[model samples]
Target: MLDHAVQSLREHGVRMTPQRQAILEYLVTEHSHPTADDIYKALSGRFPNMSVATVYNNLRVFKEIGLVQEMNYGDASSRFDFVTSRHYHIICDTCGKVVDFNYPVLDEIEAVASQLTGFKVDRHRLEVYGTCPTCQAEQTHTH
Candidate 1:
């Protein structure tokens, strides 16, 4: 996965610095949709000189080059997802965990909307939110 990410970055004309490599490595293996602060906290100890701003900048670059997706879940901070494929997310309201699930694209809805509005339709986003199993289990135990 790291090699694939490196190849993709090279193909997109992005410089492969050590910091960038570390960031890519983290993203490729992570599914939690971490915020920039989460990334910085995890990496700053290793890099020593790295800053939160650097993480944010690299994430912006990755997003612009289609290497990552920025997700806003009504939180104060936006999370980043490395998976670029067409997939939906299920967010845990209690624990704030983000999980990915694949479903067939709903092209029929787009077609119907376009027909109704007489405008071209683009893409769409879907996110389902609820308490995760762990949270539910915890609630049961507490009660």
Candidate 2:
């Protein structure tokens, strides 16, 4: 799995540094939609020289190479996902967890894009924000 991720990264003109490989591999394997800091913390113990900024830079590289997807939800931090297939994201406003989802009807939205925006839209991004099951329970109990 990680080998495929690293191979994709190298094909996209990104240097196959250990840090870059580690970050991309983690993103592909982990589904919690982790942020750069989350990754840095988990890795720093193993790699004392790894910097937080390095993690962010690697993520940016991954995004540029189309190896990773980024989601910003006004939470002051960008979330990252490694799945490259066209899909969407769900964010828990309470716990800040993100989940991946696919909508079969999303093609209709793309079909109307050219007519509505008057631009030759080739792709689009969709993200829905709400409470996850765990967060919903916490909210109900807190009330």
Q: What C-alpha lDDT values do all the predictions have? A: 0.87, 0.82
lDDT by residue for model 1 (14-115), tens: 899989888988898888899999999989989999999999999998898778899998945899999667888999989889999987655477788888
Worst 10 residues of 1 by lDDT: 102-111
Q: Estimate each model's TM-score.
A: 0.90, 0.88
Best by lDDT: 1
Ten-residue stretch with the least lDDT total in model 2: 5-14
**Count of residue pairs whose backbone atoms collide, per candidate:** 0, 0
